[model samples]
Target: MSSYLLILLLYVFDQAFGESQLKLVTVLYRHGDRSPVRAYPTDPYQESAWPQGFGQLTQEGMRQHFELGQFLRKRYTGFLSEPYTRYEIAVRSTDFDRTLMSAESNLAGLYPPNGTQVFYPGLNWQPIPIHTVPQDEERLLSFPLSNCPNYIRLMNETEKTAIFLNMTKTYGDFLEMVRNKTGLESTSIESIWSIHDTLFCEEKHGMTPPDWVTPEVMSTLQLLKNFGFQIMFGVYKREEKSRLQGGLLLDQIIRNFSAAASVNPSGPLKMIMYSAHDTTIVALQEALHVFNGVQPPYASCHIFELHQDNESFSVEMFYRNDSSVAEPYPLTLPGCAQRCPLQDFIRLTRSVIPTDWDKECTVNTHSSDTDVIIGLAVCGCVLLLLVMLLFIVLCRQSEPSIGYSHVINQSDDHS
Candidate 1:
């Protein structure tokens, strides 16, 4: 009797002493399925074949995000209130029709207008602002950024690695056949993904591939495509490449986590959402050192949940690339557990999160420096031509031209 009483007291004490609370959630997801961006010259279908033309989101895409939003609503039932509050959540997306619509669709499911939020009786949707910037100006969430010359050099270096060289050698003849058959000028490891993408998109939409696209051919193409994704961030010197590519996003996630932790129960910010692309997911998972090496499928999502337990904080991550699974797969940082202490999580990821992206992205190679010099030289030459034209105009204006002063006739001047 005394033992049972002690056990009950201990249980009560444990329950009353500390509480674990959900503080914040960050969700980064790829836009749902889209129409093929384009087709090869020799392809059977062209831009006229797809609905609303190239690279637009499909109805299926809308349904995917809507379901995902429903999943989130169920997952965070008690944490997120029924009606949406602008103060509780913030959303951002890449400036594209597909992503913007995906975010809108996701929000439609996550926060359907209820009671006070319902402005209309007929419609269940409410207008929520999703912020975006022009594509060219975007630094965050863009992958394999072309503006970074140093990153280009890294790709150059990566190609020389043994794995890359072996793949190139093995696929050389196949690539030649692809180039000849598809009317591409050339097909190499770098550009094979485009062909694969066109084929994959077609197959997904119930369109059969050409006669040449056997199952074995499709398998090989997918292998090469996955390798291409690896090349962008993980083939060689993965961490450094991530520092320049995906680390920017990871840095933001940490910042938001820190912000949530500092304010604790007082902060109104409960969730942050980013609607992006497959490459965005790849870059981020690679930075986290938790990528499974498979291409993130459409509607794939990465989740970061910040928890406050008593006086300490922790972060848990999940990847939901497979819709078949009832729950998202738990993700752990390379050197940490599934529920990593906030300080440990930050420390483990310190190397990948860049301190100065521009400085780190700078290359001191002679060729790159020469390119810079050449660019400067071209600018100087253009400037000099402009100055000479201006001087000539000023001289003619100040001391009138001989022809201007005399008004010489054409015959008189010739004579």
Candidate 2:
């Protein structure tokens, strides 16, 4: 009897302790390093200098993503199938060549060909579909979306803040220096960063730095560049800005998690991966209140993991910033446990998540009024044109018909 009791106890303990299971995972990663999108007017290396020109991925970029893929494969060893399965995972990327190519490179490491799946002999790669919408239509992975008038207004207001003013005053000399050095016509905060970006990329690739680009200058430029990024997404009205920018992505991720935990779950997409820009990652992080305030490095990845135990579900987040690190750092949402309950996660993030993105994007009364006024003016112009056309037709009808008058004269002459 005691033996049977012991067996029952053991079974119960095992059931209680081992019941937790990982259900779903979502990952958003920035594309790896690339050539500069543009060079300074005086830059020796112009568009023609790069092998594939500006804005394309480099060889190092492909390797970074491939290694990241391998890391994913190891991390989800048993959870994901050994062989590539279309139903098990879905990948999405921005329409840009670098992001799209990064997704392809990542998949190559994640899903190597196995067991009769080899299309080309000795080649481990098999074509996996990486989906994307047109760039203009992309809302989920794009940052600082153009359609949001409220965001634009917020940015304009942010520029007027004392912090921005102070920054401009502080960096006025540096900005002017860069303009003179680069031979560029304009040297706004936004444009000056491109010069730093070009210099940084060139230095990374072992090219000699220009004589004017001293270490002190580069450091100052980096600081300004980071400041520019902060103001773009986080300096003013960060939460509201997130509602229009990163919140869209967070809302979608939350929805995916909730759907996976539903009683009636949909198809078998266990993992969803997003290949995007650093801004996309920063935006989402800011929305989650986890932004570190620095620019995300190349190939940085943010992971959202879902876990289920008994009748309860929870969410966990991790950030992998460095490839050499043995493990990703855990991120805890404020006001919640490390493994936050799904309900709590949703509730905490509800404010940032927009109910109607388009409606929220047009929240500015001034913009709405302007739109209304413009619409009314256009309608008035169209109405006036229609009325003028009608008046011309009426005048023509009222006039003595010329053809009829000619016919009458001829008849009279004949008589």
Candidate 3:
């Protein structure tokens, strides 16, 4: 009787403790604060106004990412090794100065100099590798990828939709007001966002705004800015757009999770981090159907935690929008539990994941038209060659008796 009771206790303990274990974690975070990418034509702030020029990371940006790194260290205290190990964590960033710097800064906080690894006594920082591809060749994290012709067609079709047309009609006066105030020749919902961005950046950095930018004007600009985001990722055919945009990142994350789950004992990669832009986060969330339709704030992070329970794998997602918040908000995938099973998670997202990104981005008609043109050129070339040969034969035949008599006379003279 005692032996049976002991066996029952062991089974219950295994069921409770051995069921769930964290397998892997993947995090995608927006680069911290940055100078506005560009100033409007009429804006007082020019390229010379910014210390490092436009689109560069500010000092505060580095501090923000460093704090985020510390938070990650605390969150994964036991999961990640205390000392930085090259084999355990991999970091990748978009090929931009701000993103690369942010990743470097974050690493400073995550792995402070310790023991023999510290090369200098005074310096708390150590070198960590952050991988990146060139901007034009990048596909994983770059937003509104330029090479996608199908996405461009989708944007054009979206502009023709009734909803988009109504939006343009409603906002026509506001756009014109912006164009006149900014001294710009044309103004669209997207272009006007730059005005708001410049002002927002200036205000954040303690610069006084221009007198013409009233509270009401700022409000309108904010609304239009949000509308710009909607048009980019949400408004029309959102799912298809996501497959071509955010879905690319999602597919990579899932593959990483699946691979981690299959590894025996533990995976070599304990953490994978991405340093990217606000649009990168928005696109991924839009594809996951969890986007709140607001622009992700600077330094915002979206985390994916994979867990294994009783040999079954599951995925969990979290979003950290505010640094003040002690804990990140839990995000549940649509049509699945908060901790979604791995297979179900993959199945639900399969539609948004693209198989051949380049092929899908190419317009079908353009490809077929190219093939047709090549076919016609080949046929035309063959016909031209045949005609030239036939003309040469006819010329020889038309030379007639004079040519033959000349040849015979020459031969008799030689003999």
Candidate 4:
């Protein structure tokens, strides 16, 4: 009777407190600091740009991501096998130069391959593969390319959303006021994007900004620029939804691991790392139902911890702001992830795969109103005939007048 009572008590406690065994982690973070992508009409940074020029990482960014990598190394040291097993870890970066370079710099801090077991001195690095796809082929990294026609149409609609409309009016008024005060006619989303680039460049190259711009004014402008990005990328539902699509991929990655775990305890993929953009982290948080208002700062990582119990498997979330820090904020995954079975985690995220906007865009709304397919076939036939006639006419123009006589002679010879 006592043994039965003890077993019942243990089972109840396990069910209530929820003990989890975390074996693997996959992290996604944004690139470090970078130069402005482009310049505005009234911008401080121009074509001549900074010392190193535009769209490049700064020294400060290098330090930031390096520190982040070091933090990961320390935090997972015990969980990871000794001597840093290459197969146990993987890193991927977006193909942009800044991001690719940032991953390299960050890897130096994270791995630091040399300490005691080395024949060479002054070397503390190992080559870690950072996979990437072309920026044009980078839907998995950046959410919803603005160039996509459907996404552009949605952005137009998003601007009309009450939240976005109000912001547009507010920013318009603010820009007008700024122009009135500074006598500069350049201030818009297109302009604000370059404010940081200008400041970073001017300081780096030792060029002074125009007299109309003061340090305080530039700071305000910078804040406003970031705010605009937040509104456009975060507050806007259409953009956010597109972002969520990118995050859905990460969720799929996690679910795959969980399925693998269900079958084997210590098979493969003990840890995974994704060196990505701030938007990657933000989009993922939003998908997990825990997005903060501000974009995730540089090197900010979202960690997914998966565990399995006797009865079921579960997942926990953690966010680390500083790489040096050991503690991370506990995050909640919405719907089934809060407390879910492994099979359920797999089932739920499968629904999140984004519907391709290109396919959606190509859907003809007018097809139902007419026999458009038949009409298109008829039109195509007519167009082909017209093309054939034009080709014959052009050929005749290029041919000599003796062509008919030659054909008749050949036919007589054959007879």
What do the candidate models score in CA lDDT, each in turn? 0.90, 0.91, 0.90, 0.66
List where candidate 3 sits over 4 angstroms from the true fold: 1-18, 263-267, 365-415
Q: Residue-wise lDDT of candidate 1 within 1-415, one digit each (tens)?
A: 9999999999888777666789999999999988888899999999899977989999999999998999999999899987898899999999999999999999999998988788989898999999999999889877877788778888999999999999999999999988888999988888888999899989999997889999998899999989999889997999989999999999999998988888444468889999999999999999998888888988999999999887789999999988889999999998888999999999999999999888878886677789999999999999999999999999888984556355669998889
TM-score for predicted model 2 compared with the true structure: 0.86
Between candidates 2 and 4, name the one with more favorable TM-score.
2
Candidate 4 Cα RMSD (Å): 9.8
List, residue by residue over 1-415, the lDDT tens digit for candidate 4. Answer: 9999999999999877666666678777777877666655666456675556677787877888888777777877777765656777777777887788888887777777655644467666767788888888876667545555544555566667786566567678666656665446666653564555556456654667677567776776766766655544455663345433554555556655655576555466667777777667666665555776554766677887667675566666788876556687777655654555666655555544455545544324466336777888899999999999999999989987864463357767889
Off by over 4 Å in 2: 1-11, 366-415
Candidate 1 least-lDDT 10 residues = 399-408
Per-model RMSD to reference:
9.2, 7.7, 6.9, 9.8
Clashing pairs in 2: none
Model 1, position 296: C-alpha lDDT score: 93
Regarding lDDT, does 2 or 3 come out ahead? 2
User: Which scores better on lDDT, 1 or 4?
Assistant: 1
